[model samples]
Target chain A: EAEVAQSPRYKITEKSQAVAFWCDPISGHATLYWYRQILGQGPELLVQFQDESVVDDSQLPKDRFSAERLKGVDSTLKIQPAELGDSAMYLCATTQGSNNEQFFGPGTRLTVL
Target chain B: AQRVTQPEKLLSVFKGAPVELKCNYSYSGSPELFWYVQYSRQRLQLLLRHISRESIKGFTADLNKGETSFHLKKPFAQEEDSAMYYCALMPGSGGSNYKLTFGKGTLLTVNP
Candidate 1:
């Protein structure tokens, strides 16, 4: 079965450092999303991409967070000058269409201290 | 703005017993409802969608437009059913947004 693939299942970084997480969506999926899940809270959308265009990034902390899907396929999420509050599980999900079901990756857990 | 609410933080029940997970949503437009599950150390996956009107793993959920609710139900729970459940909603449109709003999630534990 095809699945969303994520790299670096876990990462620990110091404050003020930079960290990056990679994700590859299921083949043929047109919509991709990145979410941050804080402990004991629901996952919050950070960025969303349709093909190669960004549809939304309102909730993303622009000062420190950046995400891109260069070819509209594989994507990367990066955090610069990471803070303690930046520690959380980053989830990547994709859907064939806007109204279809979404498939999620295993997620990359980041710890910043 | 659209949002989802899962009241219970945790729910515990014995195997063979019935189970229910409450989910409520606040969305003015016609919303698409879904239930997703995350098993221990596993990736989150789709459990059921309101439109499908089908049960999965002995679980079912009915969308109540009047009440703005879609509560998940299982006649008899199994040990394998223990997992975190999240309710999500998608706005109705070209749906090109493809953004989903998820609830905090309910941790269900079924003891054998």
Candidate 2:
């Protein structure tokens, strides 16, 4: 079974530091998404990419967050000057098209002091 | 704006008992609703979608436009069914594909 891959399953950093999370979607998937989930809450979309182009980022906090899918397969999400409020589970998901079944990765649990 | 509301944050049911996880949404146009489940130490996976209208793992959800709800229900619950479940909505008309919204989620604890 093909599954999405995420690196650094767990990360802890102090406030004002920078953090990055990586995600490799299932092979041949064209759509990728990044989401943040606080403890006891559902995941919220941060950014979405379709074949290397951003589809939606209206919810993304542009001030400190950035996401990219250069080749349209793998993606990276970065947060600079991370704050305590930024501590959450960073999840990556993928689908073949805009309105297809989404597959999610194991996620990267980030903790910022 | 699209919003999903899951009133209950936690639900505990005995094994073999009937279980109902409430999910409600607010959208003007036709919407696509889905149920995602996450077991212990596992990634989130789709349990069922309203469009499919097929029951999964003995769970079924009926989309009631008048009520604006798509609640998941199972006639009999099992211990292995304990997990966190989320109700997601993809507004059909004007909402973008990537603008899906999810509720806070409900933690179902099926006691044996």
Candidate 3:
């Protein structure tokens, strides 16, 4: 089975520094999602992409966070000037259709000092 | 706004015991419900969805429209069943714009 791939499984950075996470969705899956999961809480959607176009990003903090799927196959999420509260698990998921199962990646754990 | 609530943060049961994880949701329109599980060092994976009504790994969940609940249940829990479970809800037909609203999650520990 093809799984979503994420890099830098763990990251540590200080506040005010920049951090980035990468994700590659399953082949042919057009819809991709980025989520943040704080400790003791469930995942929260940060952004969604349909191909290379952003379908939704209302929850994303535009001032400090940005995500892009330039090639429509993989994506990159960046947070400039990371905050302490940004310490969380960043997850990437993908689905081929609206009703299909969303496959999740192992996630990138970010710890800001 | 749609929201999912899993009241119990932690649940423990002995092997072979019946286990139930409560999940409630608040959505005005018709919603699709799902249960996702993450075992130790494993990525989150779909355990089951209400639309399919299928039992997976001896676990089953029923959608109660009247009560706005979709609780996961299993008659005989095994030690390997210990994992963090999340209940999620997707509004409408789950089109491209729709997103999943997840509950805080429940940590199930099936002990020997």
* Top DockQ prediction, candidate number: 1
Per-model C-alpha lDDT, please? 0.94, 0.92, 0.95
Give the higher-TM-score candidate: 1 or 2: 1
Q: Is candidate 1 or candidate 3 better by DockQ?
A: 1
- For each candidate in turn, give its C-alpha RMSD to the true structure in angstroms: 1.0, 1.3, 0.9
Interface C-alpha root-mean-square deviation, candidates in order: 0.8, 1.6, 1.1
- For the predicted complex of model 2, DockQ is 0.73
Ranking by DockQ: 1, 3, 2
List the candidate numbers ranked by TM-score, top first.
3, 1, 2
Each candidate's DockQ score against the native complex? 0.85, 0.73, 0.81
What lDDT score is found at residue A35 in candidate 3? 99
Every candidate's chain B TM-score? 0.97, 0.95, 0.97
Cα lDDT tens digits for candidate 2, A1-113: 99999988999999999999999999988888999999989999999888899989998999999999888889999999899999999999998774557899999999998
Tens-place lDDT per residue, model 3, B14-103, is 999999999999999999999999999999999999989899999999999999999999999999999999999988766676588899
lDDT of 1 by residue, B1-112 (tens): 9999999999999999999999999999899999999999999999999989998999999999999999999999999999999999988664688778999999999999
| Ranking of all predicted structures according to lDDT, beginning with the best and ending with the worst | 3, 1, 2
Candidate 3 segments whose C-alpha is farther than 4 A from its true place: none
Pairs that collide, model 2: none
Count of clashing residue pairs in every prediction = 0, 0, 0
